[model samples]
Target: MTVFKVFYQHNKEEVVVREHTQTMYVEAQTEEQVRRYLKDRNYNIEFITKLEGTHLEYEKQSEHFNVEQAE
Candidate 1:
């Protein structure tokens, strides 16, 4: 499994802003797996970035970098 940072808007009708967007970390085998694991909602998906190497290391420094396991 790999860690991914998903940026999305809670409301699909609202315009997506980088600053206003919400983020979550998910563990999944693939990008498709991550997408499918998310709850069914009207989410304005922004970006899904796979974190590894130095990037993953950097994120670990933050207090908010909690990984969510996908069932």
Candidate 2:
């Protein structure tokens, strides 16, 4: 298995809340698997913000790790 760094955003719709960017380290064979793993960890897309100007996004880091680790 390979290690992946997943970058995602979590935002709240409150009046005085800032958007949150989160990172996750996942061990999977493919990027799709990383996404699935994140979902299983309760990072579902429904929690992401979908505002008109700013929308939450996620991406797999270009750097790969042989071991599992996260920040």
Top candidate, metric TM-score: 1
Best candidate according to lDDT: 1
Give the clash count for each candidate. 0, 0
How well does candidate 1 score on lDDT at residue 58? Answer: 95
Whole-model Cα lDDT of every candidate shown, in order: 0.89, 0.43
Local accuracy of candidate 1 as per-residue lDDT tens digits, 1-71: 99999999999898878888988899998888888888576788899999999999999888999999876
Clashes of 1: 0
RMSD of 1: 1.2
Q: How accurate is candidate 2 locally (lDDT)?
A: 0.43
Query: How does model 1 score by TM-score?
Result: 0.89
Clash pairs of candidate 1?
none
